[model samples]
Target: MDIMIAAALVMRPDGRTLLVRKAGTRVFQQPGGKIDAGETAEAALCRELAEETGLRVEAGRLRGLGRFRARAANEPGRQVLADLFLLHLPDGMEIVPGAEIAEARWVDPAGAGIPLAPLTGEQILPRWVAGAFAPQQAG
Candidate 1:
């Protein structure tokens, strides 16, 4: 079971979310990565965001999204189980795409590109659509 941890992160005042095109990834993805055993999802979230996007995310509500199973683009026939968190970072934090991240862009939830993780678009986007987008706009 590959324990993938991911986030749907919103940007302030623009109602956009952070999506990363990883160096070796074909699909754009939320700022996220895998979780080592013994690490809570929140810790993994903060660590992965830092490693993947160079931002220290402040943990918000842990939505406890259930596992998602799918064959990722390059991982044919192999399924990964992902636990996702919806996180928010400090206000005014500017992003610098990290080594694993080829490029980072703020994507309007209304117009997100094809998510690198299909299951991410399937599961995460609805939540982002319902509520996450506005908080950023309000800020």
Candidate 2:
């Protein structure tokens, strides 16, 4: 069975994106979680952002970036379908890793030099490079 999730491409003004590593996991990914039944994708994402990163973002702040499908990063023999969104974080916003998140990083998308989730490496980053979700380019 495929996992259904909501993910965020969190961007900072400095051309950095936020990625999170789960506890005991090495592959870094966009911070998000499984969408609950009867929950809107935006709503689930809002809840997930707060849970994983201590960011209280309203649903209105999430710009839908459409859906992407890829192999599950941590689960073998399973696929994942993600409803992705773009979230431009405010300046000086603090990110405190919470719940199962072990570390949060601000990375230059061009060369992170870290192991990334398949969804991030294959689907998201390519699109990001194409300026699909990024509304503003940092100089």
> Against the hidden true structure, what lDDT does model 2 obtain?
0.91
lDDT of 1 at 34: 73
* Model 1 TM-score, all chains together: 0.75
Which candidate ranks first by TM-score, i.e. highest? 2
After TM-score superposition, the amount by which residue 102's alpha carbon in candidate 2 deviates from its true location, in angstroms, is 0.5
lDDT of each: 0.65, 0.91
List candidate 1 stretches off by more than 4 Å. 58-67, 89-91, 130-139
lDDT of 1 by residue, 1-139 (tens): 4536555454545556778887877787667667778887677877888787777666654444455665664466665566665554455878888768888877777667565566557656665677644443333
- Pairs that collide in candidate 2 are none
Best model number under lDDT: 2
Residues 31-137 of candidate 2 have per-residue lDDT tens digits of: 99999999999999999999999999999888888899999999988999999988888789999999999999999887888999999998898788887765533
Q: What lDDT is reached at residue 131 by model 1?
A: 63
What are the per-model numbers of colliding residue pairs? Answer: 2, 0
TM-score each candidate: 0.75, 0.94
